[model samples]
Target: MSAPAPHGPAFSGRVGWGSRPAVLVVDLCRAYTEPDGPFALPDPGPAVEATSALVEAARASGRPVVWTAVRYAAGLADGGLFVRKVPALAAFAEDAPGDWGALTLEPGPGEPVVVKQYASAFSGTSLAATLHAAGVDTVVVAGVSTSGCVRATATDALTAGFRPQVVRQACADRSATLHDTNLADLDAKYADVVDLPEALAHL
Candidate 1:
């Protein structure tokens, strides 16, 4: 068989799954998943279903399962740059209906829920410390807006000395193009982007 022509410059490196792993579910809230919910995506069904599976695998393995949500203060004063860049962020303000921020996953007792005003779960949040305290050396990332929160969290995970593995089917975005593009980029340079089955096997 003939080798395919090369496309872009090779961006090489892999941060394989580490000994201790944690599942980080980012913003799979009603806002992004429910059709009538604020900040709703056209279709988050697949990602929601896939993430539920990841959560189950994590639980079965007894790994830490952490969740992240975006919530701005009553007036959006704390949102700052992020809100200004994406006005739709106002949907996450506290003044909005409670269901908007409701998580798709039914978090069990003692599961930590990290709240942030930015894309990265680690930004202005104790996520890294939480992971470190739990002795987690690898972060299994899954959630909404593949081009945004998932990507940001995965990138920051790498910077924080944790191997990030993004489950492709478990991360979503309003735009398929954006989702696929960012996943490709992440797989190339930042994280290991694997399918749902592979992610479960990793767990």
Candidate 2:
């Protein structure tokens, strides 16, 4: 079998930072960070630290910081088909034990928390409107499961007319392969996959 052709030269357009940018911390809850949580990642320390730095930088610069977390009604009545697809989402149930859905990086004063039941933060949520109201033209993304929520949010951010800058070191997945491949694809098409320092500078 031959190797697949490279994605380069064609999808290589950069949607760099815009005049107004917001830092979006997606689903950095205990469910993914804690060892005993149902959806725990193998190593979330580095990603968490990187994300924390981004948050601090955004706050220091007076840039908006928005957070998203999955939360379902009792019995997951609001979870819809997504819960069936990923049963582990039960960890985010409103009444789940150990506060598994609690954000590991707590939002500061005046930061909005967007509760969602799906992967894409913009799906059925007011994220777009929130960003628009704040005059945010670019979204600096940092969070977990690179192949899932991070990818979904970045794609949707582009569709909603926001420049998506994904912080490479501020995201984690079940494995390194998933993290690297998804970032590569996102950088090629949907976003600019940047390092923590670049993201901080943008803030």
Candidate 3:
């Protein structure tokens, strides 16, 4: 890790990849990618393209790929507290039309899709069990909003006994400050913040 964040204790260590791994694509739905969508980030192109390449690489390597989306019913009853905190979540309503919450990545036939109501993909979802059942000890995580779902998923992945290797180029946020800050924290504590090529080679 670089020098300690100006205000926090120094953190420096690497949790190397395990023998078995899976790719966890977090919240790369149209709601976060489409230019005109309610939750769209500023210029999601780089993250989208990088993640697409990583997805293809993982598939070629026969690694399991898990995708996630934030989808709730029309009433927002399923969203609960999360919806209240970020009213923008209403854009992800499952009943919404015209790709408001469509998956940007083309999930393969056998790839499992996890629908989550919270920031962490493992929260209120069966992601940990699915990864465990598949013997996935390391998770190659990528996708949108590095400060939100990507960061949360990485933290939860660590808590669930999986190594989270976050690909920097494959994750993004509307603000560079949020993206970099979260990446620094994740690398310093919860996970390994790696480059796209490094993660692809591991796959």
Candidate 4:
């Protein structure tokens, strides 16, 4: 078995914050982060607005802004039973929020908009390499489905050698209780859970 990380969200263990921090918006696509859309989660409107502000701050500091969108090929062929099981996910039309309108923020000249299929942004995606190439050692994470995509991406970020800070107030899910519960877990185990003000305080 792999040894537990010597340091986690609870303590940095003397590893100071990174100089290059990026903003990673996970699964903010129209499918997940909307109210009346296919595969919509919950009240993701305010969360998206908060994320937009965070992106602005990251840009002001000249940090890379990475937005992750979820897209899978038609049929259960590309996504297997995962797609077959969630029939609503099949309705993600290219013209919908699945295209990520609310999640759209101008990437600085060299920023990235990563496309993904699964919950974890790092899964079958170039997120790790992209962040590394940008010299980003810390990621400010925000997104939809607090119990799903956000959690998955946060875990992957930590595994791939980046400090991931989950913006609790800037993330949402289908259930308010689920949102609060997942945020608690993320704070205790997966990632550092901080609200928008706390995140902006550090920035």
Per-residue CA lDDT of model 1 for 64-177, tens digit only, reads 999998888999989888899898888889897655888887897889999999999999899999999999999999998898999999999999999999999998888989
lDDT sort, best first: 2, 3, 1, 4
TM-score of 3: 0.93
Output the better candidate (2/4) by TM-score.
2
Candidates' RMSD to native: 1.7, 2.8, 2.4, 5.5
- Prediction 3 global C-alpha lDDT: 0.90
lDDT at position 68, candidate 3:
95
lDDT for model 1: 0.89
Off by more than 4 A, model 2: 1-6
Candidate 4 residue lDDT tens string, 24-83: 887676666555676576566788789888988887877778888766665534665666
lDDT of 3 by residue, 85-167 (tens): 99888877766666677898789999999999899999989999999999999999999789898999999999999999999
Scored by TM-score, the top model is: 2
lDDT of 2 by residue, 12-96 (tens): 5899889999999999999899998888899999999999999999999999999999999989999999999999898788887
Q: Model 2 compared with the native: what TM-score?
A: 0.96
Backbone atom clashes (below 3 Å) for every candidate: 0, 0, 0, 2
Residue pairs with backbone atoms closer than 3 Å in model 1 (clashes):
none
TM-score result, candidate 4:
0.82
